[model samples]
Target: MIKNIIFDFGDIFINLDKIKFANELQKLGISQNDNTFTPILNEYEMGLISTEDFINYFKEKLQVSSHEIKKAWNCILLDFPIERLKFIKKLAKQNKHRLFLLSNTNDLHISWIQNNWGMDLYNEFKTCFEKFYLSHEIHLRKPNNNIYQFVLTENNLQANETLFIDDTEENTSAAAMLGIHTWNLIPKKEDVVDLFTKNHI
Candidate 1:
């Protein structure tokens, strides 16, 4: 009996273009093969650093302009399908279960989403969730036990009664370890709208 649902935002909702982002970064001199920025990225996602500091790090290291850095960083974000919105909206209206959105996102990407989608649509999507959790806002990132624990404890939810859906195996696996049900949804091949038929909930 699943009574709560947790969803991830990136590939699960809004599309992301990793290869395009990588190509953009390469233009700014960060090689696709490089893992040097992973720690800083994690830190930024966890709200450990400010956006200015994040941009400055790249500016100083690569001697690139802030505009270029921001452009490269934001290029990964793509469209949010209308059907998914309709699906979530209908689900929210039914009020059958508590809904949540948990994503490992940074300031720049979220800001771009707000600017691109505009506030009305953004709010429409946001208001569908009982609790909306962003990594930067929550100071927590997924695949770590504590973040999931925080959401469960804060919501007074039992792990066994919650279903977490994410596009990443690493994230879903971490949630599963805590006894929560999870769907490691494939991006293009699978869609969130098929939750009932696919997850058999």
Candidate 2:
């Protein structure tokens, strides 16, 4: 009796090139070995730091311009298939389940998405959900137990009756630990449009 659905934004709806950011940064002389920036990135994702501060930090540390940093940061985002948007919209219209969107995203990535997808399209996608929670906006990221608990408690949702779909194993596993059902959907090989047939929902 799954009455609630939680979806991850990246890979679940919009496509992402996971390695594109790292590759783009590499082209700008930043490598994986530059681990010091990781904490700042995490802070940025959690909304603990302002976007200007984030850009400035990278600009000072990497000696890069704001434009370069923004470009590299947004390289991971790709396409949003209209078919998937249609599917979610249809699901929302059914009114059979409480729909939620929970994504580990930041301002820059979201900004890029709005610009790429158009604000109207983005708003249409958002209106499909009862609640749209972004990590930066909520100050809570996925794979964190508190974030899952926060969503559950806030919505008064029963974990056993909630289905969470995410592209990351870590996120799915964390949700499962709280008795929620999850599908660690494989991107490219699987599409959210096949949710009913593939997951047998």
Candidate 3:
């Protein structure tokens, strides 16, 4: 019996366009092969660096304006379907299982979401969770054992009674290693609204 559920924010609840984001970055002379990019991005996502410093680093290195950098950085975020919101709202209202949101996200993206969704809608989505853990705020990111351990330990949740849903296999695999149930959902084809029917949860 799954008593607790952990959900990934991107591609699980909100849509993401990783390829488009990468292409935009490539146009900006940044690529996956750029050795310096990933570490700093990881640091930014882990909250090890301030947003100002992050923007400054890119501004100096890419010789681009802060606005351009922000625009490109946020290109990965697509949209949040209303049905998913309705589904989560209903699930949260039932109070059948403790809910949590764990995502690898940063300040800029979150700011965009807050602005786009408005405080009321964002709060509506946020209130659905018992705890909302953003990687930057928590200083922890996914596909990492520590993050999963922290969530479980902090909530006093048993691994067997918890189910984690993520769009990435790597993240789900890591959770599975900790004895937590997981569903590595495929986006587009698999909508979270069909959670109970599709996953038979």
Candidate 4:
């Protein structure tokens, strides 16, 4: 019996254009062959670097304005469907599972979300979860075993009874290795609102 649920924020909740970042970067002359930004990106996602420093790094490397860098960075984010919010709200009201949100996100992305989604809507989405964990805030990102262990230990949740849903296979697989149940949801094709009907949870 799944007594607790862990959800990923991106793709699972808000729709993302997965290729948007790469395309935007390509336009700015950064390509897959250019790995200069990869480490810094990982650092930013892990909260190891400040947002200002992050923007500065890009500014110096790309010789672009901060606004342009931010724009390209946030291009991956698209929209959050109302139905998904409704579904989570319904689940929250049920008081059934101990719900949690674990997302690999950074300060810039979150700032964009807050400004775009507005505080009211963001707060509404936030309150639905018992504990909302962000990578940057927690200094822990997904696909890392320690992060999974941290969530389980901190919440005092049994791995066997916790179901983690994410869009990334690596994240889901890592969680599965720790004996947690997982669902690597396919974006567009798999709507989280159909959790019960589709996954039979």
lDDT scores in order: 0.94, 0.92, 0.94, 0.93
| Higher-scoring candidate on TM-score, 1 or 3 | 3
Score candidate 1 by lDDT.
0.94
Clash counts for all predictions: 0, 0, 0, 0
Instruction: Sort all candidates by TM-score, best to worst.
Output: 3, 4, 1, 2
lDDT tens per residue, model 4, 57-166: 88888789988888888999999999999999999999999999999999989998999999999999999999999999999888999999999999999999999999
Per-residue lDDT of candidate 3, residues 10-86 (tens digit): 99988999999999899877898778688998999999999999999988998999888988999999899999999
Better of 3 and 4 by TM-score: 3
State candidate 3's TM-score.
0.97
Stretches > 4 Å off in candidate 2: 32-34
After superposition on all C-alphas, the RMSD of every candidate to the true structure, in Å, is 1.2, 1.3, 0.9, 1.1
Q: Tens digits of per-residue lDDT for model 1 on 1-201?
A: 999999999988899898899999998988868789888888999999999999999899999999999989999999999998999999999999999999999999999999999999999999999999999999999999999999999999999999999999999999999999999999889888899986547
Candidate 3 overall Cα lDDT vs. reference?
0.94
TM-score head-to-head 2 vs 4, winner: 4
Distance from true location, Cα of 156 in model 1, Å: 0.6
- The lDDT, on a scale of 0 to 1, for candidate 2 is 0.92
Residue 143 Cα positional deviation in candidate 2, in Å, after optimal superposition: 0.9
- Candidate 4 least-lDDT 10 residues: 28-37
